[model samples]
Target: MSTIILVIGYAISCTKNDQVIIPDAGASSTTLVSVNTSTPPTIDGSIDALWNSATKISITPTVPDPGNGLFTGYIGEQYAGTLRSMYDAQNIYFLLEVTDASQSTNVTPWYFDPTANVAGKTGWAKEPSSKTYDVNGNLIRAAWGEDKFAMLWNIDNSTPKFAAQTCYASCHVFTPYLDYSGVLASPQTATTPPTVSNSGSGNHYTNGPNEKIDMWWGRLGYITKDASLNLMDDNYQDYAGGQAITNLTGGNANGRHVDGIVPDGTKSTIWPYRPNYTVSPTQGEVGNTQNLKLDGTGASVAVPLWVIPNAGSANFILVSDTTSGKAKKVTAVSSAGVLTLSDGSTINPTVGTDYQRTGDAVNGPTAKNSIPANIAVPLIGGRADITCAATYTGTGWIIEYKRALKTGDVLKQDIDFSSLQDQVFGVAFWNKSNNQHGIQPNLTLTFKK
Candidate 1:
């Protein structure tokens, strides 16, 4: 086993009646076993010297069963990675490095279309296609979203099934209505009873009430960055009465929710994380500055509420294909709904104003330059517990994360690692596709004492 040596020095304090003593620095040194360090590694994306002494566990992508719908028919190229972990007296740390080919940051950007007759032609563009089918003509793989990573851990061991099934413990697929050819039918509209026809394989929920799982979700580029730290969305999974057979909207059926306040203004209510937009338009007639602006002729016209005038190459990127792009930074947005960029240039708010030609998968011929729809902001409350630092190297990604072993979470939204017990956890990676992901389940984590 690898070991890390930590050098320590102490000075003796003495009163007038006591003697002062100085300890030799060489004799004061102590060696800490790998994975249990007296000094914690820095929470930066770069691999530090201390990491050399830690154990490296290989991480390979695994396909899920077709019935479960969690990457069932994925035919994409498989890539393997490595994982290393260490713990201090107060916090547990993780270092995950994955093998990826490209760096993808753009997520559903808005494109401008001038030829369209209707006003406000700017709309969200669909991602490029990269889907593959199997011999039976079943859709196997689809790519086009943002790069992401996630970890699911059994909280307090409340769900014993997680020890054996890992991520599969919470994945429950309801019965789907079939077609005439014995194939699964699409979800019908206005059905008498709610069904899982549109459930797309399954949803995540615990087996029983009060059971919980801690989910650490990290988006490679979409999440907020504080200094060098990229904050992961701290989330949890629990039972919510399973699929809603009565409600057609699938209300409260899926058990995955953020670790924050619920809808009834109650801290216990389960609510999805709302994006902190730079500017959200108020619902009203379009003439105001919020949603739509007034044209020179007093006609209601739609214009982008905010703009990053000269966002540098690193913060902002213009991509032609999925593999390559130019980079730029998204500095900040104007709260006052000002269209003037930092360079003193103002954008024309006319109905036919053209931004640029951004490539689109759906509207191929009229691809236009794309603008980001929203900016990344820090989440509040327990949802912000985990902080991460991630860097996308030319060939892969380096992600480092840290969180307290015991967070004083009154709602039990987090896993308690203070006991240093062997933890049952699973990991998944989404490489550009939102619905498809590669999972590594039934994994065990044993912290060094």
Candidate 2:
């Protein structure tokens, strides 16, 4: 905290060097909010009147690090946030909003196949670790990333002083750490030492085994909409809790690290996963949403994005499928996405024009920013405990989280709200795309009966 001060002389037109002084930064505050029983608001990521009635708590930095050689992702101030929370008899809901400059939607996704230099077929990249050098091998680890928000709750009051210390209770500053990059390869000895590639010291687990910290990890883009897929990674920080493991018997929900897709390498056989993420409904291209339609013959053409099942649902007709030679009506059901029948059956469209209306022209659907339900990419985790519905409203992101107040199975690592006491929770943010996250801690939410 340095400051430059200008010195003044009375008569001699003073010739003196400017003095420098340093001052301490202003104090930071903790956020605390109380909640009353209320109806569950629609989990649409919009600021509705329901949330307006609840107490608002600002989530800012507690302790941040300049990061250990992992590029220049400093913490303590960048991606600050505010949140509102309330619970009903059945479910607990959270609405978190953040101020982010940009979004990183590309996880390990299928890009131009380097081998074939083609689109669509080439396997996806395992991680977004592309680096550029100045013709010198100087490592330019520029950060490019997707937006993510996480909340770690110390359930059962097991963690000592977690609420006061927040995530710092476990986030240790281990020395001689290495960053996780897709391109970099550390030499492996005959013993295969524990490298930063396998285990990192900076962001490693800080909790104890089986102690249980409920981690509600939410992600945006990579295939889904702003903040759709919300999964709870059941975690208890263990110095030995490694993210990279071969047998993912418990799945990624246990914080196991699965390999990302790489060209001409071992591929994953997980179904419904688009390379690295769980498939999601909103992962479709937002520009052109496609629906289902029948031609005069038995064939189908890519029409428009499906309408959800409801009174407002859409119905399209094609005379080719009807014996009356009249346009038969196809009604949209509750299930949306993909050009498909109301019954959720496949109605294949003509190859070229039907496959997203052939390249450049937006000749497909009526909605400008819509995604066909069927074709949209999805999250790899399927559905998670904490589910969200979020969309970027031009400025920042408005996300909604919904989960059962009590998951009943505490053994499965669910956050137990059955007792309804003030529990310790910490939050983190990732801003400006890439892996750079903002570290903040200790926002308490107390619920009243």
Candidate 3:
């Protein structure tokens, strides 16, 4: 809800007929209402007065002119279009008038369509009657209309400028009121200085005497100064000997340009320019996996699950834990449906022995010493002990054990081994404590060479 007020550069008329009007000089006759809340009371006169006063201060002459030729060139370049200043404020209404005689000859009143976009398209463009020239032949741009006007203050300068092409007017408006304290000022003058109300104490225009117009022009790679308002040489140069006039035309058109109204009422573009101030919300990386802490209740947080590369083939695998945390490898599955792991090893589960038996249970050779020379049991028996001992592990479980066979030995058992050959297999672990507890550990098994 805080307000920001920016002092955009002023448009000085070349001709006296183009003079800007100040509000009638008298104590406000109507009851002044606070603009802080929704559905603020109507006080048109006070709003207009405050707006005019703020505009006057923004246009007040700060530094001496840089001679007529340079000033004219600056205006000519600025006429092409240049962003002057940007600020935010509360309920105070602000207007920017661009008198383009070439574009409009009659009373060209500035009007703005404050409506936002719909379906990703601007509603203003659809409103046929949104733009019109006023009776004075000046291009008038107003911010809000009716109840929607309240949303105007909520707008940051960039959105309005970028979305609705508000930059076409070349003038920016700031509202509420800003304190000019600590801002450099011209010496006390015969003409009464403009009075500024300190309503929004912290709010001030981004560009001010402390931040000279020259500094902005330099940033924009172009220079600008008023030629008609020059003081003596003593007043023209700063103590550092740097001329007050700024050169914005850095001699490059590398940056995009926007249009602005010149003092001569001409439409011109300001090239390679940047705004005096900007505000941006915090943003996060696209593929960040860090846990995002949420603030306040009912707030939702989103994290990216996976990324699909634009090229190559797409396949789904269990999310990798190793490479995800450190150096992990996404097991590559070959076109033959073989799962290849980083280390070379082939896994093919046995059918009758490796798999669980469903039918009648096999009574063990009751005693290891009283075993028959050769034992015979149904292939589909409920369960058979493949190894003499219940459990023994080296690389994999010993399904059928032999005392003389060494590790890595390929020993074939004659009990229907064909049913298990070439069958793909996967390993799964269960937490013995809980039947429901199971986990797929970081294991990648590949077929042997």
Candidate 4:
């Protein structure tokens, strides 16, 4: 039976005894905190077990009717199979099994005749020898020669694997060799041939390198490429059309010269091919602002933190004298991109300078100046590190301040503050301490509203 996991959100109110207390208010109770209970899924299994339970598919080679001396050995027939599995964590595993029972006896090798001056032929082309099958006898090769094979996967499917009415090995369209081998009397005996290395050498596999192949291999659970190409790791010119062999020969044959080995004790020659890529998160970055409503239900009071642009602003504010107590009211005039006070005094809004807002009298006849709400009192050159005290409750922030009154009273102003780009103002009652008692007084502060 399959197990289905259900996740539920529950709020818990715990007392000093470590026991959960469910309030009578149900889920609407703000005194409780909700918690989610769910674990991420994963996959666990051995490589062999994974391979056996995966989906398996076969790829084979096709035989030409008018036997081209090209695929001669045992009629150039072979098949390969691949197995794929997906783990619980969505990780994908691929195991390729190749079978070439004919082995060396069924090998047919050919090279492109560079001097042949064929219009489009530029590299080595191999044509396998013909094969004759007896009614009740084993397959026999009418001729014998060296053989090489390469398998291609449609990892990206950018290009057609095989052209119509043509075996992939017939047209010599996809050459995995870097340097076309010139016609020679005998084939090279070295295990490593002089042909360009498809896996490296920066030649045949120009589009898909080993590094790209590995990345796609790991990300298979989350992504998939269109097509893949498998070429013989060795330098032999035996190319196969894979599972689409019939597509290449106009329905003449159903498969190509590919083999599938279950990858036992031997290392498989197949390599995944893919293009270079960069991974980016689908959700992107987080934003800095939240919505606020005026219905008294949204975040009303919030600490204002201004990010100053430069050091000049910082120095200007740092040198300002906050203890002066005396306030100044001056008119700010801007012209020709320059700012100056009405007193004919010019102040540079650079770092280390203190800016004061000026306006009409604030409270009584004794006050000659007051900070105006329309005036900007900016501390210039302050770095972007400006920070103010704020209370964050997941959804909002609150800013707090105190108010002073002439009645020798002090009170707190709890205004729903928004952004620093605008002015703010509020009123509250202040409490004063008398010689032997405390008194309350009406108080108000008028600055940048």
Candidate 5:
């Protein structure tokens, strides 16, 4: 039978029933107390009044050694942040503030290319790199990647090494030649791809079965506060065995998986305006007929699916403009097969140039701040348990979120805090790149008596 999970508002209470949730583990040394609150803070990005008196925890993340010769290539500035927690009878709320020089919103976004055809999408371009790498082949910064934060909670003490290793417990690095499990009879290289059956280089899998960790992932560029969905991808990690690769694509295998069924079944079909992203034909106003335009020679050529109308003040749309619904997107085409903007202006094709939003001027027609690569959609099912909001203040980011104290998920996808027992968890921050991140492990969480 399908379980019914209630969606509670910021003012409503979703307390734990009379059920007792007993964990199979013990406590740690350092503790971050979750103080009691008669008045809970709102989950908006703004700092609320009740947060002034709550206990806070310092979070300073640093790059971790993955143990192999493989390097994260991250040479970006390291910054520290603060974490605050509070709880009432029904829900637990969190406030996270971190320092960052730049607000990276875009990942890999599509652009209008006049002379290229990728995967049958003719005249389209996508940024491959930020070109900000150092001489040592280390990634100096993520000029094109988004800013992100994540937390992993130990589930029922299933992972014994969690308090000590934290994120490392679920992470395994593979060499270019050797496999951890010795499952493959032969060695593999960068050219030879590694599958679950074979191992070469990659990580993020649990050591054994039944070892589960609940993950709360927040992407600054992907934060959505709409009713259809919110930000924060509710994911989890379990055993996929040693030598298994991290699952970038959605699924239950390869360790990391979303909270609901396989393939992100609860993911929203529509996209929100906040955390603005490049629109596509399927999800936005662009249509299939607008894919191509007639050139001066009367030959059909490819065109962009979307563009910012009257892009005068800025080369690209800003996050603030999207939130206010001022970022105009024009998808209508002219009778002569030319692209038209909302202001009735036509986009003339320019060879050897592309309309792109990126950090690199060489790869962009008009360089500006980055645009979001993904749209914000609410996650349904078990994945929709958490509600969140985030804001970037030019210098850093402020994120606020909340979840029910107890969510009776039959799939064991969540940890129950009704018992108020101390639990161990690990938090991480990703400045730009994906693999390179700072992790603070073995953090003990306890409720104030």
Candidate 6:
């Protein structure tokens, strides 16, 4: 975070204490719609009775804050987004939709620079690629960074006018601990910087250096961080830039911990989650229920091997030769024998992106085809308190997140949603894997019975 930039201007807080990020864009201030439904909305991103009728708040692009020196806004009016909010008596929900042209999940866990002889290096340009340099930086140097989203909630509404001036209260260029080698860079220091000089930058909470802001980070790395499970990470931004307290099942703080170059990296670190066709029978390809077309231009012909797990979940990954080890998630697992990949393509693992690995009788860590898919121990606690699901409809992605209104587990970093008071929150979206994100600050979610 030590990317020093000369601050050309400074921003003064002028927004009202009651401001809402998406107010009357045509819709009224009833942005937080409460629905007391006994039937929980399916965590599947589809427009259902659970969330379809809820008010859809249009999210416009957030212009760059010239006053903020770390300003890096890549979304230049290119994409627009929408959001939906709903809550039952026990939980709060948010569905965010963002327009993205492509999906990029090449996080540090999944990045492989084989020619340069590094196994789990990052996507940065410093990595050797036989002929060129891996330039995404030791921490990050990839144009196609991981796809992600985040939600920021004002803790205890402590900052004055947090309900209205949500994020602005904390944007004072306060850096969190990102030092990979410094002895002082412990997780505790990473969560709350020990001093003003070593904090690094970008954390703007000035009044109270220890002021906590609830931040939910949905990095694509987490989705496949585990070979068999799906996850989204949770962290908070305070004195330190951003720190995640826990990882999802099968998730880790840093995928490249084997080498300590990026030791400070969090689970949100840019890494890829390669596919493991051998883990379960129905894991990668389920008998090629539908036939797919292949590129047919490879030097060596590719093969597809259908596998089934011991007790596989309803989820499946789409392995394709064209996309290297990129695995797309296929939710519909019809037992009828015919497989429909996430794309409208058939299940015959011979299509452009319909490829699979085949080495051992079953695909696991030892499977020849999936030799690189290192299966590590999942995260502790798994942060089950926060659950989210998303579906991408061609132009954009629709995401749904659900969490209990009360925090009980100290391990999960759960929120204390106990009282009926209103809370302040902010949302951000990543488009097509760019490092820059579109952010909306100071959103209010009023909890009422």
Which of the predicted structures, 3 or 4, would earn the higher TM-score when compared with the native?
Answer: 4
Q: Look at candidate 2 and tell me the lDDT of residue 442.
A: 54
Candidate 4 global lDDT = 0.19
TM-score of each model, in listed order: 0.66, 0.53, 0.16, 0.19, 0.66, 0.51
For model 3, the stretches where C-alpha displacement exceeds 4 angstroms are 1-21, 29-124, 128-131, 134-279, 282-449
For model 4, how does the per-residue alpha-carbon lDDT over 1-449 read when each residue is reduced to its tens digit? 00000000011111111111111211111111111112211212113342343344322222221221222232222232222322222111223232333222111222122243233222222222223345665453232221222112221222232111111212221122333233331133334443542211011111211100000001110011111111111011111222122122111111111111111333213221111122222210111112222122322221111112222212111102222412222233122111233335543322122321122212111101111111112211111011112122222211111111111111110111122121111010000100000110111111122
For model 6, the local distance difference test gives: 0.39
lDDT of 3 at 361: 23
Off by over 4 Å in 5: 1-30, 67-72, 75-77, 112-123, 129-142, 176-200, 224-229, 241-253, 262-372
- The Cα RMSD of model 1 versus the native structure comes to 15.6
List ranges where model 6 is wrong by over 4 Å.
1-30, 61-63, 66-79, 108-142, 174-201, 204-206, 224-229, 239-379, 410-414, 447-449
Cand. 3 Cα-lDDT: 0.17
lDDT of 5 by residue, 1-449 (tens): 00001110101111112011112113223468889999988787899888988777776655444333222354222447777889989998888888877665555544544445433334444444244556776554334545678888878878887776665566543333222232332233234543444222343546667788788877665563243434576767766533322221111124666675332223223211011112222221112123443333334444433455434313223334445655434354333333555556665434223343335444333323222234443456677677888777777788888988897677776878888888887666766543345556667788997
CA lDDT of each candidate?
A: 0.52, 0.41, 0.17, 0.19, 0.53, 0.39
Q: Best to worst by lDDT, what's the order?
A: 5, 1, 2, 6, 4, 3
- Residue pairs that clash (backbone atoms under 3 angstroms), model 5: 73-138, 73-139, 229-378
Count clashing residue pairs per candidate: 15, 30, 37, 73, 3, 50
Misplaced by over 4 Å in model 4 are 1-47, 63-67, 76-82, 85-92, 99-150, 154-157, 160-449
Please write out the lDDT profile of model 6 over residues 55-86, one tens digit for every residue: 76665544333232232434232345667766
- Sliding window of 10 residues with minimal summed lDDT for model 2: 1-10
Instruction: Quantify how close model 3 is to the true structure by its C-alpha RMSD in Å.
Output: 38.5
